[model samples]
Target chain A: MSVRHALLGLLSEGPKYGHQLRQEFEERTGDVWPLNVGQVYTTLQRLERDGLVESDDTASEGTQNVYRITGAGVDELGIWLHTPPDLTSPPRDELVIKVLVALRMPALDVRDVLQVHRRYLVELMQQWTRLKEDEGEFDFALALVVDSELFRLDSVIRWLDAVDGRLKRAEIEPPVAVPELPRLRRRLAVRR
Target chain B: MNVLELREVTKAYGEGMAQVHAIENVSLSVERGALVAIMGPSGSGKSTLLTIAGSLEEPTSGEVFIEGAPLSTMSHNEKARLRRQTLGFVFQDFNLLPGLTAAENVSLPLELDGMKAKKAHTIAMSMLGEFGLGDRASHFPDQLSGGERQRVAIARAVIGNRHLLLADEPSGALDSVNGEAVMRMILNACKQSGVAAVVVTHEAQLASWADRVVFLRDGHVVDQTVPPPTPEQLVHTAQQR
Candidate 1:
């Protein structure tokens, strides 16, 4: 799922510039992995540096730069095609991890994380809505996203209220007591 | 008679102070042509029971029988053979081959079992056509929509006439409308084919689709419904206050 290999794989099909790559990637994957135009260009630059891909920088004015997979890129793409892509080293899902950590942290700011998640869910809902409204028929990729991802987005929206309640309860709860605190503090004070 | 059964199934984790009885003395049955669901909370051991039934994992204790035969007696190859010939699975994730087209995914089991490529593709295409995805049969998994992918998985599962069709949270990934469509398709197809189904779900809506719904507590079947409700009944019950 590396943008690098995806870029190379697309280039192997034919020459494409950054915008073309971005558009093709979205259309192919059904936007399962959102790629920005900037990401496509950056990955193209890296691929060029690695010699896995080549680009003609001297394109005529008003025309986009044309990039194609190199010999090495073809070899790499072939290997990746046969092998299972390593998903273990995927980009960290900070939203999931941060909330999980917040659950562990004593009196953690659950409210803050929920607020952030709420904002993100709101933004995601807008994207899904716009996509739905703009498109008449369902493309398979978009259909999949509309079904599963929208449910996930909605679930997060619903969960924010639950998290807020949990945080409010935590804030109102009494402090924990330690039975041996006074004796332990006296022992430490003597040493100091 | 029970076509499939679980006997005093008890699964426990940890030892000494940490010992947790995940499933305790649980038993259930699935008759021929039945579509049953095992529903429970997160730590309720429904998944463990399912894995044991599917022969993917060994139970801590007790016996699992499919069509009156014991799973414990089977050797690895025997189990594999039985699974290949007699069982079909529909995972919530749809477990489709990413590179393969929908038709190819449906054809995999048949090919693996030594069916001719042309024959298998013919059969697979017919199944996809049944599910209204004939036109998209050539589309890869990534190219298909979520609902389409699930239907493809269902097609793949039932393609070979496997006796038992087991699904784990099959509709967990679908939207309400698409989920309803998948449920109807699965139930109707299984019923018509006379294939026994065991669906695992936490969602009440999906559980209702089962011919009979079984509720789990810890690891045991705590409750069971008789004369399984109709789809209309299920929906009415779901909407009840």
Candidate 2:
């Protein structure tokens, strides 16, 4: 989600100054990711520098400058939208790091740490749930935001449960060490 | 009017040292045209509360009421008849009979209550049509998709003016999209017919569709809240900071 690409995409609609682009971006994304006006202008300047967008000399009455997407900008936007996000390696997740570190500590129960985090995630999910209820017939963008947050939190909770179950099972029997996937037990070899 | 009520409801299993109190003096009421959701972890006694409220089991020492009438005063046959006529249930597995077609499945409850089969089929078809399954009337449960099967189960549950709809993790077997579709159907049923519903689920998102949510833990009602918080608040707070 490059700000430059977002501005180019917005300009694809027509000529839009920095303020208008900021408003449109917030509106379309359900204001989940609000953009600062200064940041918007900075990105627009960079986009103009890169020849992805060009500023118009023809003055529209109330605005300082109107930028339109160039052919190159259109091409760039197309490519960016089509490109799949990289998922080769896991992103740095704070909760995952915390849980892994907690598991190594002798004094703390990893399950208890997982429970604390699970409760927080559940509370966050509840907040999103409340937002959906308040919206009643939710707007498309708002609904998507709420739905994604709920699903993500739900998955995290499920992962916690899986980790807790596996940890308990490992306690009952000595776990086999696997170098690549520490803390995860290796599967037993089956007879053919 | 309150369609369902529980007063000091306590359900216990076994006796003496082995006794486990599934529900402990929990009281709740669902008004006409309202949907209430009960949420808790496993062993939290959510199912016990629903079963006692539905009159499937007698509470050891509490009162259950449906449509302002007390369950304790009713005879066994009266209670059975009440369940058949006034109460309905939707389950996680859908519980549709494989031998019956969609229309037949929806109409079974009405027909069992002594309605003419033709009349029951008519009501069932109309309900099925409302659920967007009119074209699949002749299709058997095995032929329909999971969503369709659940819809049929819901239509059957609320058929013939059965005002109290009790569901236990009704969408537990569905994907998120299908789970939401099921919730919409249930919400529509409550709105269109003024039927009161109580759904027990672990999913808070699904519970958001209800008018009120009751959280239970250790077989006791810990908290109840009307309308949970929304996403806009978080975004606004972040923006402010």
Query: For this target, which candidate reaches the highest DockQ against the unseen true structure?
Result: 2
TM-score of model number 2, chain B: 0.94
lDDT of 1 by residue, B44-155 (tens): 7888878888899877788899889999898999898878888888998999999899999999999999999999999999989989999999999999889999999988
Q: For each candidate, what TM-score against the reference?
A: 0.55, 0.76
Which DockQ values do the candidates obtain, in the order shown?
0.01, 0.27
For residues A135-165, what per-residue lDDT tens digits would candidate 1 score against the true structure? Answer: 4145666656554655766666556555555
TM-score of chain A of each: 0.48, 0.81
Displacement of the residue A78 alpha carbon in candidate 1, Å = 62
Classified by CAPRI criteria, candidate 1 counts as incorrect
Per-candidate Cα lDDT values, in order, are: 0.75, 0.84
RMSD of each: 16.5, 5.5
State the C-alpha RMSD over the true interface residues for candidate 2, after superposing those residues: 3.9
Error of 1 at B90 (Å): 1.2
